[model samples]
Target: METVKEFAGMAAGTLFFILLTWALTSSYLEEYDLTSAKPATASVAAKVGTKSLLRPPAFFVKIRQDDGSPSEELHRISRSQMEKLSIGDPVSGYATGPTGFSTIRTIVYDSIFYMIGIFIFGFISLCCLFATILSIPAIDQAEQRSSHKRAVKKKRERRKKKKKPKRTRSGWGLALGCVAFFLLVTLPFLSNLVHSALPAGKNSAEALIINEDSYVTYRKHEDSSYRFNIVFDDEDGETILAIKDVTPNTYRNYSIGDSLPIEYQTSNPYNIHVRGTTLTDIQQMLLTWEMFLYAALFAVSGFVIWAYVNSRKNGRRDSRKGDRFASR
Candidate 1:
């Protein structure tokens, strides 16, 4: 019966940890625009209100003449040939019709869905946290029960009194400190909580990529990322510079002079994102710190249960030895 209880406690702890992790991940993905698997369906033109690239079943390309007019000449081009076009050279986008969701709509709807996800994940996390907290005392009680059984066994046999385990003042202080520290670190707020309170903004402009500044990093290996400076011109002829970071994958999707669909706050134009980019990069940094805290909690929960079970087994073994001595 004791073994069964121990097994159940361990199983519950494991399951709780797994659920907590999944909930956290789901909340993160939902908060950002990372849930889509389909490619962007927005039409790509060099500038808004300009003539769209001609669509044909067969691939074709157009070049700008020295006079800045579209050349009458057309070239049959393959995908590889398209890749070879020089910067400032005009080209056409994919011929397929629009299909993917708009970046602005996705961001607006994502914020609403993110709130719902946070509530669900937050509720589950709270329940599991309480269960974990209750398990600690239950484990301590199990140890006390094992100790009491051994003490009663000795009393029945007329043996010398055994000394009880003594916990020193420092031990009590250390235990209380650990409990306080655990609570402080595991309290979730840095990732999902911060995002939930962020001021919601709808991006209403299409940003034209004017320039790109690339840099190489050696964080994990040789890799590159880019910071793009884009210009957003409003209907009143006011132009704003919006800077965006592009990962290697996102950088491949665009080039200089390509117009990117984006959403930004009117109050803060610097806070902008390209349609293809998700806003997970910032949350990811916060997650790295919280990951260690949760990992420690999971390990401590399992360890406490294991220690309780081991203590019970040890007590039974000692009680059996007492019985053999009494018989002799």
Candidate 2:
């Protein structure tokens, strides 16, 4: 029964590793193909809009073939572009084989960053799969030998005085810390990095300013801070309720009903910036502090993973040595 259970566990682990490797490899290859493909011109056959309470709004342009028939390929576009596009409008983008079409403007930055991540993750998964397969037999043999020794020791232990085993530190603290760091620090910073790297024009539109207001925040020691808010709407007719923290000069320059160009993420409309003023510009203005912060985060995460793995190996070695000494 024990042998069967051990085999089952090993089989499950092997299967999981295989699936992980395949998934990562597939994602990396797909992104690579998309990045390398040449741009093609396709005419828009129809405009498609999708939105659900659970998912963000997405816009697509169905491609029309040379024969004036609609093809299965759909080119994703920004909401602002979708609103202005008409049937038979020429669209230039890369065809992702059967997946559909993608504009270079949309995937260029994403391909650079995401492809690197996918490649690294895929390589690690492949290594882990091979390691697991190679180590399973040896692990089983060691477990069997250890079990026999443990059985013999149990017999001797029954005849001797029972002694308390020393408790080892649990890994729960390290595990929790990693989890918290990933959630609070890693995810947010990575998201901001991606958003900041997004280029203007491709993911942005000119929004009409519908209203403007200003407020003062009274502080204890610091001088009162003034915040200017602007309300605008995109071409899609979706209203952006508030744009906060505009400079006093900027606030005074723009009036109600004026056009205020803004850039926004295609995935989330709420993530927006004024046309000339962006997160990227801010990072540059601050001497690329955001980039340094990202580097620091990456270094910290790598160190933590290395430390955890090393500590586990050391703990196992120490435990094995203690067991051997106890047996004698």
lDDT of 1 by residue, 177-250 (tens): 66566656554433323323355744557888888777876665333446666788654455554456655555
| Model 2 lDDT tens row, 204-257 | 676666555565445543322222234445556665443443444455667778
Predicted model with the maximum TM-score: 2
RMSD of 2: 15.4
TM-score of each: 0.28, 0.33
lDDT against the true structure, each candidate: 0.51, 0.59
Error of 2 at 116 (Å): 38
